[model samples]
Target chain A: MSEFLRFVSHQIEDFAMQVTFNPVEGTGTVVYNLSLVRVEDLEQTISVFRATCEAGVSPSSLIRILYAGEELDGFVIPQNFCGILTLCSTTLDGLLLQRGIPSNPIGGGVIEVAENIPKRFTHLIKYEYTTIDPLQVLVSQEITSVHQVMKHGNGSILGNIRECHMEAEDDVEEVLDELTEGYFTGILDLGLPNTPCLGVAVDPQYMGLAALGGTNWMAALREEGISVTMQAMKGLCDISTMEFVSQL
Target chain B: MSEFLRFVSHQIEDFAMQVTFNPVEGTGTVVYNLSLVRVEDLEQTISVFRATCEAGVSPSSLIRILYAGEELDGFVIPQNFCGILTLCSTTLDGLLLQRGIPSNPIGGGVIEVAENIPKRFTHLIKYEYTTIDPLQVLVSQEITSVHQVMKHGNGSILGNIRECHMEAEDDVEEVLDELTEGYFTGILDLGLPNTPCLGVAVDPQYMGLAALGGTNWMAALREEGISVTMQAMKGLCDISTMEFVSQL
Candidate 1:
């Protein structure tokens, strides 16, 4: 029986494009391996992958483009680039109107061969697109801030609240310095003035950086006599580790 | 600004091994890319990956092995095989004691370079290992059986249950037929007489087959007047899509 199983070798002959949306930053990053993909159908293939995300939200203006380990020219979305796109809004309909792209509803589908790529390569492409929603945010907030912090330290610190907003800012900087070490660096994006929170977006190379950053940030906030509730999105699911200041 | 972004293009260059244990089948499958690993260090890398799982549960015996794309000879555990292993139990201490290997407690770590692979290749391997406890089984069973069925049909016909044990078996066979189509396939493992349940384990190539199969099997059981509840394990976290007969 084992001898007959010699014919069962399988290879991932398919290429995949994963588009992750950072709702806090209103940005989405498109990632695909160039070596595994055919150069000819790169444009249309990306368009379809983009269409999957567009089904959920529209992408407004291209922020940055990287191709084959180099940044490309112009803000105009190129046919061959496989990097990040900073959208104007997190909503699909809003982004479509902002970008002036006709909104055609493209529902979800499974892995399929590239439209124009050679059939001989037996190349397959799968698109995994997901957006951060209110429920996910609320669950993340409860987990990172309320549950995890209380588990680490007692709630008596809440009574020792000091009006040290400046000290809290310094703590934030220190936390950022620790998180940005090595290949797992992240950027901090401040929310609107009324929101009083910070959003940190990290690259996809590291999966647990967002969770780790969020935990450290929450701990730092607690240390400064400031109370903060944070919501973290995992790198595998979302584009960033977000730290929302719920209390201060 | 775009030119200065040269520091951003970082690729994964390390090798990894992922071992997933299927509790239902009493088996564990070790997956690693042959092209990305060294021939000599394959044994050590697999040991590390296995150790990660063995850190959780021990195995009783070796079932089978496959390398590259073919199955190797004997249960002697060759140095190059990369396929599946059928174990006796899910406990790590049990497996270590059974295999007579010293228990070197290596905690979880990230990706690292292969010992002899070419540096130019820059191939990256990622390990994702998780075991499903009884709670996962309960949650999966509740979701796949109750929620999905309630969504698909009105509960009116559930009261019209018949004593069709034979029919329920036939339905199980039909559901398995649908799930086993194409590259995706599964096996049904019956529980002990006292347990009164069945476990279905599907390969990792497909994600939602267990849920699909369980839903179909439950629906079939309902038609036969045999009320059955099932839980399915997804390939993302578990080795196979497993449907456990929760209640009958």
Candidate 2:
């Protein structure tokens, strides 16, 4: 509706079609962005998890993650530890190699595309959190819907979410336990550390949920007016670290 | 149980006469220090929320607040927004002021209390989200209990829950929008922001829960082994602002 998106260098595909054919927030937003991806001929979606799991990397290097591909921006690492009395959040390689079933990273809703973003890469990307247990680091961060982000000022609530994941990966578990697990019973954005090195990558990519479950969760969220996008996590897949990243 | 309480220079008086007790923490934490009030210590219990709402001073200001007398702590800077918001947390006060009325300001059953220290002053006091919507300034925050804090941090969850006032406030339109409310659907602390501030409070005062039901909610939380505290907003109330503050 606003010319601001155009001024921001974003494309405006079917404004009338959105207003006419679709009138819902989630549906409309996804259609608009999908149109952009279609016109631009950009790779719509990529299974970063599957690619990352295939790449076998080392934990110490803390670099060269599996989902290192094009159009993928970030990732959500949810690991709960039973040993070391630590908040234990290891790298992708460590997890895939040791964690539960490689395909069930999200536990309940596997095989579906991760949803939090809407149009592909635009300006910024976000990662949203739902539940995170400290005793185990068990997580419930589903990027499958735009509702989570749009409800709060576009992608405002999730902006910090991805950052905390990327930058605070090192101190995330310990600090998360201290900052969250201890006193706070309420849940909002897991207040990960606020440091330069501690941030998440938000690539403006697309993963169509239409093929997965008739609709993409992130696209649905965008229809609700959430400002978000996808990332390039599957690009780093190098085959060796495939099993290792899943267990971490 | 441990000698940790010895250094605070304060003694729990309720242990003598009534053993004021109220078990807090559904399983985690919320604003603490306020839990220092015991169930039997009606005067102090009433004063904690009174201070938070009326004075707009956090729990850290308690030592001096008590010394300054209730009136001074209750004083506001003429239409002070914080003072107004504090006063708006009057639902519980109605129940407190009118005994024999089955209602709980601190919450239904689950109460939470976190340790209170001089340092955690700014962190340990969270009022529910009442001041919003009905008044649209800040959400009305109440002296919440452990169950309420952990289950639905912002108290917005109460929008759908009418434990005491069910059927009285029931409306078809309201219930249908429950999904969009997104208030009570996820982890209380990590879900929707209750109001304006983050529900993260840390007190280094060394004060623990004294009693529950009538005792301070803080003491109740410690027994649950939660080291942190944060309470979000919930439902609505019908009481004078001051009355609500006094009761909460």
Candidate 3:
């Protein structure tokens, strides 16, 4: 923990100011960049996660650490434990992959919403042609109006679209049902076979699906004038080590 | 025709320069904005069509005037004639309406293409929320790379998506088949029930369809440094008065 704090201090000066030794007060928070995790080095992953939390991307109340497969309630890493974490952008990809369903990551963009219903995508950048995560790019550019949507029920927010084979429709539905039952917040809309979702077109023989971007919260935080560091689809860590913000 | 010429001269100056009064050379070109046509006023529609053509939106050879319904091969309007002219954006809307298939115009966008195939949309704007036609907006902004698409089979071009009742699938397919048989260049893609046609989403129980925008030619011309004035979906006129560029 001291080493992690030292690392956070080296990376960001303000992180130390936000950290509180009291775990019960929830001032200590950790965010794992799901895309950046190195599974082979669980120790490094843990260190990075801790360092990020210490970096104070958000108030502890707003930090969200989710376990994908099974829920374990604790902040401490259990020895020999392994599990998956989910970010909204890559949650469905991970889920479908676990079920052996091939899914393709397509594009990420800003989805405009009105009265809490998605109206259309106002901007899009295709995944194939971009070097960075499109959502991250949009967020960093400060182009998203997520805070307005949250406050007024109308504005633009981050989302992503992807497609899977037509044959996986039933399986996809089943997964969606499970996610819904689990109260997942990532899903935005799913298209029929060969259809578009959220006004975006899909390839023939494939169905498009959209999810709220994982960095949406980060955008919202940034919109609120809070500083945040996000690593989207970073990598993996044991679910056992995660503590939900609510629990914290 | 003199009165129409007067109207055209008042609306644009260069249109007179392009009018060679040579039928064989195809210098006399007219484009009718299908949406702006007050069906009750056929003479006025003709006047507007002629005026727009005379405004020099395109070169004589590149001018395309499409008849939506039954074909009539003539450049003169039969007395008391009533017929439909199709712009790519309004063509499907008219066809589906004729068949009692309730269709909704959803959006207009710039679709990126690679190797003669659509990859994804780099930009989109929903129709329900905008006053101006999205394609026209994108084209007038000089943002489309249609010339590149035409020359290299990769670039961005104009397209629009719409949705219709799922029950109208057969009717829509029949219309598509007929259009295909007629060698239509407007049809871009069609989605399965409740799917998006080109990466745009549709409502539940509706299917999405997309067509190349009629303004695509204008964009291509503009990309090559041609200044073109466009009035998309402007109105309608008798199909008999239309002359295909090849026929001319």
Candidate 4:
């Protein structure tokens, strides 16, 4: 009775994603892509997206894009905004890597920057994770403000992500937390554009009990010892949906 | 025991990744970022990765650098080649989506042909999926091949792939016969690039237990039926190291 079961027969691993860019600084436009790909054969299951968002001016206009969140097409920023984003790169943790200037690039490493986080736009991002496979398939999402830069101009925008946020409701988190038997964790983030860059160390392992009910790829990963996996939302922005499905 | 186990007390889905490119005909380069985000607090985890690869007329030329991999970084071409790549993209499924196409702009989509593809190169990617919590954290990557304007550069690299005859060893079709369980499918693919773009659906019930040892996440999902995700090499060209990883 699930949408996937009714439509998709081959269960390998498939994912579809879309990203829309709202250029508030340079151009008021929305840029997004909807794509799907199969993990086993690198088959492009789907690929398409739309981006709209006009360009804006000023650093505040740039930082406002952090709210784009991966799920929404676009959002408008307050015409009157005042804030300064200390733009630069600083290694937070991990090895002396490019950004991993600190041990493990995937193990708690990041780029840090602080902006005048707006009050109305400051939405709490509570993330939840589920492993689709050991190395490749996993889903971790939430509602948060994600900021990004455009290739054209020297500015950025704040993105208000609601679709992913809605997916990770308070109830969903509760279920996953109890399912994982308390190994679940929620961190308080300060970085505006928080992204996760991780490597698939092992093959993917889908978790969850189907006979019980319909659970998604993420919900199935809990039984294993995996509670939390790093997130990297940068590669996902404005890409064709096929990109995600091909990785499955 | 394992290098990551010492401080890896808490159960976590850890990861790392590398993307390399070698443009043969025209010019090809890949740009990407690595990231890490927290599951609970979406704001905490952040990371980035940026890299590029351009195929020299041969293999080694201007800036000589040595790294990993079997074949030397210099000119090395085999009789035939094959590869198995595992990646998840927003549009791997090949859904026709209308992304904001720029009017009087530079270009759109990753369909750029550099009029070339270096002799060959392959990357193996894997991720251990979590059972619950779906997160979409990503890093964008671009692979631009500057060929001889083969078809005015607007053609798709995935339009030509048909069989697995490009490998250095066994054909992928033969490998399919080796598996009795799991599902196989070929929905989309990149012909010239030698990428499959296929899918591998699994029941998880049987595969989760057998492949994951005793800790299969599928144990939790009794029967709704699930997918056991994996990737296979597409190119006939074989690299010893890559072959080992693909078998998993």
The Cα error of candidate 2 at residue B56, in Å, is 3.6
**Minimal lDDT window, size 10, model 4 chain B:** B206-215
What TM-score does structure 1 among the candidates reach?
0.21
Each prediction's DockQ against the real complex: 0.03, 0.01, 0.01, 0.02
lDDT of 3 at A192: 87
lDDT of 4 by residue, A1-248 (tens): 11111111011111111212221222211121122222321111111101111211111111111211233334222222211111101001100121111111111111111342222211111111111111222222222112222223221122211111222234333432332221111112212212211111211221111010001111222222223221122122221221212232
| Residue A26 shift from truth in candidate 2, angstroms | 43
2 or 4, which is superior by DockQ? 4
What's the lDDT for residue B224 in model 1?
34
**Model 3, residue A221: C-alpha shift (Å):** 38
Candidate with more favorable, higher DockQ: 1 or 3: 1
Model 4 misplacement above 4 A: A1-89, A93-102, A107-248, B1-248
- In order of appearance, the predictions have TM-scores of 0.21, 0.20, 0.37, 0.19
In candidate 2, residue B25 scores what lDDT? 11
Residue-level lDDT tens digits of model 2 in B169-241: 2231232234122111111121111221122211222111111122222322333433212122221211121
TM-score of the second chain, each candidate in turn, equals: 0.18, 0.18, 0.65, 0.16
Give each candidate's interface RMSD in Å. 18.0, 20.6, 19.3, 14.8
Reference-based lDDT, residue A195, model 2: 26
Clashes (N, CA, C under 3 Å) per candidate: 11, 133, 32, 239
| Model 4, position B117: C-alpha lDDT score | 31
Interface RMSD of 3: 19.3
Worst 10-residue lDDT window for candidate 1 chain B reads B7-16
